[model samples]
Target chain A: MDYLTIIQILDSSLRLATPLLLTCLAGLFSERAGVVDIGLEGKLLAAAFLSGAAAAVTGSIWIGLLAGVAGSLAFSMLHGLASITFKGDQLISGVALNFLAAGLTVVIGQSWFQLGGRTPSLSGDGRFEAWNLPFADAMSKIPVIGPAYDELISGHTTLTYLALLAVPLSWWVLYRSRFGLRLRAVGENPSAVDTAGISVVKLRYAALVIAGVLCGLAGTYLASLAAGFVKDMSAGRGYIALAALIFAKWRPWYALWATLLFGLLEAIGNRYQSIALGDFVIPVQFMQALPYILTVIILAGFVGKAIPPRASGQSYVKER
Target chain B: MNKMPKWADAVLIPLISILLAFFFSGLVIWAIGKDPVVAIKTMVQGAFGSTSGISYTLYYATNFIFTGLAVAVAYHARLFNIGGEGQAMLGGLGVTLVCLAVPWPHWTLALPAAMIGGALFGAAWAFIPAWLQAKRGSHIVITTIMFNYIGAALLGYLLTKVLKVPGSMLTESARFPEGAHLPNFSEILAPFGINFSPNAPANMAFFVALLCTFLFWILIWKTRLGYEIRAYGQSETAAKYAGINPSRIVIIAMLISGGLAGLMAINNVMGEAERLIDNAVEGAGFIGIAVALMGRNHPIGILLAALLFGFLYQGGAELSFWESIPRELVVVIQALVIMFTGALDNMVRMPLEKLFVALGKNKKKEA
Candidate 1:
């Protein structure tokens, strides 16, 4: 409505989009390497719980981050072992991993904390505090650009900035790097990559590791958002990230915009119970459902053809 | 070409898988400093020791049977229908509307009408995803996942805005009419001199689930449509060459799957709660995936798997009540079962194949 209100919404949008961006890039790497990872949600949840617990117990955010990443890495490796090494159905493996994360987090959390599957709330260094960019105060005097820069671009957790940075980094790693070309090749046709002497299994494992690290960061950021871990804290954010990945058509730069859009929708939903246009009123639930609905429509090829990698979801088998 | 005998494939694999799952679950409990043996004993006693426990287990199994059959049917056509949660929720809405539209003279007439309504709504929820997958080259898995979220949102809006009982803070519809009540297990068994727990929610829907299981077997094995579905699942190209329409098979299989998922509402919503509430399906839809996986997508196998899960659920509840072990322990067990049975089948199968091959060689030497 007003300028300040709009600024506030945009600020929160960036904050909400941080986890999505990180997780989306994570999915991008895994999917681009011919490994379908529906386990991203599980990874996020595990990371969130472990990070929160570590932060609470150790009183160190860095240790929490490490623990979170380790948790996600374990899941990613499990997924790789099942879908890559065992050549099992990738989707089923992901589904199992999700359930495993969902169950294990609460079970372990309840045992350790005895707070009904919640980590103790963190304060001070136990959480990631927002960092204001240099000259934020001075820039506020510049009117439109100042407030916009200060509010929209500046003053977010270090993870938020890293998430934004990852967009370019992912693009470079996916398109400009030598490994990127080979990784893309593996996803499109693993046989060709194999013929070229690149081990498809190794490349996929590497991609999953990268995905695991990114998911770790995302999960830690989520714990930081709540200042602790709650039961099922990831709360479908992983699925939303996957939806954003599909919406972006697996491109890194497009991923930023897609996640931002979804994030904006979420911010708006949180801010308003409903939007009224004259006599017509839109319920908040519609806003909550819009991202998924749009993804379904995009997937149905109404918006554009979102063709996935050919070898995606298929386990590669070497010919004897 | 078969590495193992038919009996082993049908029974041995699942038996071993379940054992592995329970073993791992025990390890988790031990890690948490709890006695896994005591937990298991408690679960067994709680789920089956009393008439109430058995009834509750049966009640939960009723929901699982419907959803498990839903997943199994779709699996036959190679369509993974993960939107069972949404479909079941919508099915509850359908049951609610049917039951509330008029005071039924009797549940005998109401049951069939509610079944139709539930199936229709559930099928309708699944139709778009099925059509997209069939015609537009969209991935059914992603689309179905999206539909689950959408279905939840739709149900939430309907409950808060339209279905909530007036003057009540709870986001649930008014209770169904007296005649719409389905007879519980106690009432159903009373005439036969069988004493059951009157407080248990287990109802005639359990019988309906059993009937559906029988019907599912007939549909999958005895019908031309089932043959076509299996053919399509095995190889779409070969099925096309054999003059079977892939799109038709996909649509029909998904419809059947969605309909079965919807039928779960009859157990949880109509039979148990007698009111439509938010999250009525709970996680049964997702559990259906695990059930179908453990069952190997067979109707009889699904029935057994559903019963196992029902026991776990009832037992988990008892564990939480008695030992405070947390009910999510059951979910952890379920995850392990799914992982070992579905995702890591080769891990078990390879060793068994080797054992069987070695045994066959020994037999040849003896001969």
Candidate 2:
């Protein structure tokens, strides 16, 4: 309610929103290339577990990040092989990958750590520490603006800044680049792209790889948040990211705002058990369910029409 | 004309897929420095070694049968009803309300009433998603996924605030009346001189699951509605030309699917726990997808597949208890089965087709 309270909420919202932003952008790349990626959740979980394990074992956050990306990349490639190369059902592939990650992480984690499917608690360089921005201390001494800047803008991990940076970078890559045009074209009409001599398969694989990298960052950031890995740690955030993607209508800049809104909802839910408005009280469960309900409404076109790529969720078969 | 035999398509492909899944699961066990053979032996002994083990396996299978049939029914209409989890949760709520509302003198009367309540709630939960997909061009998959989360939240809130037993800290409903308790396997078999585990949760719901599977077969193969559903699934445009209503088929198929998913609550919630608890469905709804995939959306196949999963679950519990090999090994195997059978089918099918074609040529030469 107060300025400091508002700033504190915003601070937590940024931390929560970073993973969603990264994963949403990851999904954007995959879906924009005519590949439906419901496996985004699996990739996030896989990355989170592997990154946490790597960080704990090697005592290097960089290695953990790399391992996380590699884990996500493995799943992305598996998805590409099944849905694109084998021409199997994309949704089934995604669902299977999710189960695989959910099972494999705990199995491997338990076998290695013997801590009931959890990595050791990370400390020191194994974890990502918040970076205080330049002049943050001096800025805190000033009035309301200074405290707000220090609290809201500074004191986030490096990954948070990168996630913020990724929004513009994604917008540039998707809107301004030559590859972006081709990617959009492929998603809309892959046959036309094929006719134009661009290999649909190659473009899709490339898109999946990019998605894997972004998902890797998201997963590593998640591990950093917890300071270690826990079973089922992603905890449906990947799916929430998917909803955010739909809420944003698959646009990059819009994705940032959508994820931030979702993050704010989550922050509010964490901060309050219920919100009371005069005689009326809203339940926390309602807050938890709000994003999913909004997505359904958006999908049903009750709020705004969300039209996906024309060729999305379909495999491209070249005409003889 | 260049196709494998009907028997191969129905049986052999799935068989090979299961083998591949087991092979990979064994590899994972080995990678973790455990003996896969011993693990398998332990699982087999644990799931079927004693009457208790068998009962547990059957109990788990009963849940899977309901969910598997749910998925299979929707698949026939080409509507992937992934909202089974949410539907099942809602179904539990229905069962709870029905059992608690009337202190029934006998379960014989209570069972049918609970079934209706569960089916109605589950169908109601699924109706919005189905309607959206049928009328608004929304993707059922995404909408259903959203509904799962919403259902969980709704159930969590209800259990914590409205349904909780007064003065109890547990987030669960009060126990059902004694008369409403479905007879367990031990009680059911005692009159026939068959000794069964009294402690096992396997109950009359297993028989209900079998009955549903039979009904599912009749609905899919013997009825006009089933024919329409299959027709719609194969080609909606063609079915439309043939005067079948696509929207009607989608809605009906989803309703039946949701209803079947909801019926699973009778097994776990009413039969076993006798109370509605958080996470009563416990991933059985998702398991239904894997079961339907392996079974090729057929009733008999679903039964067999559900039993296999039931065995894996019971066995996995045993493995964890004995060898410290976390129970998640079963989940890993389930993932592999789903992957090889559903997503990576062509990886097995293409090679098999080539093999069959070559064998056909060899037969011609021999002739």
Candidate 3:
């Protein structure tokens, strides 16, 4: 409850929220374009592995980011090929990508690193170093704002700031741009967009490609956090992002708040694995389960309904 | 009116898909600087070369059969119940509770009681999601998947806090009583004068899985409930027009699905591990999705698909043990199978359809 403790918790929350924020935006891009991407988890995992491996091999953080994003892009294209071009079941395609990523990452990692499905730990330039604001030290001596700025706002990996910046950027692009208008139209009514000669397929694929890049950043952030890649490092964060997306009701601005809330919950769970509540001890497992349980409750109509795009999960057939 | 025969749809498509998956998997192995042929041969030999391997293969197959049927039953009602992993975890807890509540004199006496406990617990877990979907318009896919994570955390707590053996560091319950252990394949085959590996975990639960498959076939194809489920799956509006209540079918189908998923605990807990432990369900719940798809959501097809996955799993273990190929390759292979059989079916079917149409046109010209 103290000021410093609160700042410390906020710091952890910000770190945890970064991955979720990037991924939620990723899901936002795909879902808004009429694609249900359950494979967000797969893309994140693939990117994490690729990023870690590339950084380890090349000893350059920038190369790692490039390789990671490229890997995610390849998978995204595969998803597009299956769901868009083949007119296959979108859900099935997403699920398959998840499986493929889970398997391929470990297989390649073991072969390359020989460390039981984990990448070599990165150091120095191989990982993103924290950025210190120019006036952080000087400002820390001033007053409450100074201390708060230094403690809570100044130090984060470069990707964290990028993830935060992405929210308003996403909102601007989604609401204020012509391409965004076309993208939203394709999701809601592909036929109408088709009639307008806007090329629904191209718009949707473009959305997925953007999603791939964001997922790439999310994966890279995860790798940068630990400075290495472990097996299944994405864990269930991708699913958590999907839940966050639903919690946000598919809006870009709301995604930031939702992911932060989820991240805060996780931070508290990590800080207090066991807590004394009056005479009873609260288990951390309950805290860990809270986000999922809340999602179920929200979806059950305790809160307002979260409606997806009408054209989602459907293979748009032009002639029919 | 039709160029392609129904039999081709049933058999040839899956056959070609599996072939294509293997072909691609071979290329992957080749890319990794390994011999695909030797790798595959090793997998085959490992899965079936000995009585022990066969027992293990059949044992893994039993788990897949239960979970596969769980998915298939729900699929028939147009529900994608991805919570089988969670349900099976809860089922393990239920089985543990039943086994520990009182010491039973024999496996036969404990089996039915444990099955009932597991089924009810799993059904109860699924009821909320089904209700939400049926009455509140919650998407089943999202809720069920969310439930899997919740179920995992819940099970983790239960095993660590309530079920752990006293003074033990591991997060697992104490071993079941002697009489609670199911008879293994060796014991079962002894009366027939056949030799089998006593060490293998294959047990009476395999028969239970087979019975469930038979029951699933009857429920889906032979019974009125089955007709309602299929009708509902095909066209919800049409089913409603025909007087089948959508909500009722949804709840009933989910209940059956949860029950089938729960039964998987019998194979893993009482039959193999003989102790309730964390992660006992492993990834079998997700694998059930692939099995259901490859099986075409049919009982016979489920049996075949389950066996195929069982082969891959056992073979993959062998491959990792003998060759440098990683065990994760098994998952890659499974994913490929799912992709081809489920998502990319049109890739194979479109060409086959064109060929059949051409042949039919030639026949018409001759006539």
Candidate 4:
């Protein structure tokens, strides 16, 4: 690829990867703690709409971001209650949450905006604008990789940096912290964790709550950070995030690579459409389909066994 | 849905769930700024409101029965086949392709081709996920969901680029040849004073659905293969020990799921649209899961559940004729039924069985 095009791809990659990385890592937190999060998509969609509307009304991106997080937290708590407490079927409950979110958010969008869920677009001031690292423009003058590095990697929304930071943070929290160890313990065997004096259910709930907060950030990134909310702007990214979490084998750091790969795949399709490569393109459907195909191939044994945390789908019925 | 005694428990539990769902539905009508009593009256009027409405409800219920059976088949095998939407769409797609491409010298040849095409198309869709699950041990849930998207995207690409007919973004395949269109017999029925309108898409599919449900019931309750599937569903490891191949059962279940849902092609494509539409499935495949679940994955029960969905759909459609509630309110009602029914089904299945057995014993003594 040309230097300018290479730069463009990297820039686009980061932009696309931001949401997947943030949310997949979010998924890791919950699943690794043994709480199944089938409702991540619903949570993401709900957050995106709420934040998009909030940003347009308040004209403050930060407030919008908070709104997204708060909304997602509430959504996650629903997941927590259904799967974590009631011991309902995790997959079924998750599916219900998704159906609920898709309908309820549209209902809200309809009542508030009256535009069939096409929320008001945020102003430039209300968006998290692209930020160039200091001296990065000058660095573009360097050799073969220079242009590629500059255009694709240099300028991006503030969410990209936060998504990057989130990877390490997820790793640190999942592997290094005491709660992380306890959380992992809970996921592996809740009974053991409970026997050890830990409130296995509570810790898992906390993990889900944290995951919910992260999903809020991911949704806000799509709605307020990357662009404005345009109906199903989040689309199936929440589910994609779920796939990414699996592809990464639930490891927090590997989630970065998995998310980035998906982003790159998405960016390739995006670029193909823009470049008028229709004839050469393997149908946009196929391109749009790459992630799921890759996920199936990966999950279907290519990436090796991905044994979920032992207690992943189990409900911890507390002692009477 | 737990298997309980063969009588009153099964009946009472579903009735209770239905009653609860209807009550909640009345509340929804109230929230939407309509009098609950009037809304119920209106819904009843619109659904069975007239002879035509009854015909429409019958037409609607027929599709639900197929979709519900699709879901029930998988549940029997202990698999969650969530790719119903895609499979149903593919069924229509296949049937449409055959109807358009086949230069049938006569109607007899053309109709069968369409039917076979639809079934094979749906079978292929189900096979993809089933094969993946069997060989890879991947959860059917994940692969099926992903396939649902792929199927939708495939249809979208095909429709817009290749299959684009003369229309707006709503267009799909070319219109079917006259030989391929199913006969609308409302005119004939009218002479008997028991008319089902010619305008009504409802036809033999209702009978087909009942036959299929009965077929499924027989397959599950009587056949050795059915017994194997049930065995696997009950305990895969134990079934394996009993010499059943788990993979085979899983693949069979999924194939059955897709094929049953494929019958949608009769109603949705060849029966109704005469060609593909942008959203031919209208989320019927996914809703099938809720239907299957609420029906407790039993054939007779699924038929009942399908009737309820049919009522909501026909009633909801008629509402726009006189009311302001969106057609989507029906989906809301459907979702709530599954939700509330799901909880009660779990709680009531046990006690109802005991009651049914006691009643059966008393009846047997009287006999």
> For model 4, what is the alpha-carbon lDDT of residue B117?
82
Which digits, one per residue and each the tens of the lDDT, describe model 4 over residues B261-360?
8877887788778878888888788778778878889987898888988888888886645675555567556755665555235445556666666787
Off by over 4 Å in 1: none
Tens digits of lDDT, candidate 1, B1-367: 8778989888998889889988999999999999998999999999999999999999999999999999999999999898999999989999999999999989999999999989999998989999999999899999989999999999999999998888999999999999999999999999999999998999999999999999999999999999999999999999999999999999999999999999998999989999998889879999999999998998888999999999999999999999999899988998999899999888788889899989988999999
Q: What is the lDDT of residue A136 in candidate 4?
A: 70
Model 1 clash pairs are: none
What are the runs in model 4 whose C-alpha is more than 4 Å off? A136-150, A225-228, A274-281, A317-320, B1-42, B104-112, B161-171, B185-188, B318-323, B343-367
DockQ of 4: 0.36
DockQ of each: 0.89, 0.89, 0.85, 0.36
Off by over 4 Å in 3: B1-3
| Residue clash pairs of candidate 2 | none
What overall lDDT, based on C-alpha atoms, would model 2 receive against the true structure?
0.95
TM-score of each: 0.99, 0.99, 0.99, 0.89
Candidate 1 lDDT at B81 equals 90
- The superposed Cα distance between candidate 4 and the true structure at residue B332, in angstroms, equals 3.0
Q: For all the models shown, what interface RMSD does each have?
A: 0.6, 0.6, 0.8, 2.4
The sequence of per-residue lDDT tens digits that candidate 2 reaches over residues B151-255 is 999999999999999999999999999889999999999999999999999999999999999999999999999999999999999999999998899999999
- lDDT leader: 2
Kindly give the stretch of ten consecutive residues in candidate 3 chain A with the minimal lDDT sum. A142-151
RMSD of each: 0.8, 0.9, 1.0, 4.3
Candidate 4 is graded, for docking, as acceptable
| Number of backbone collisions per candidate | 0, 0, 0, 7
Q: Give a tens-digit lDDT track for model 3, residues B238-305.
A: 99999999999999999999988888998998899999988999899899999999999999999999
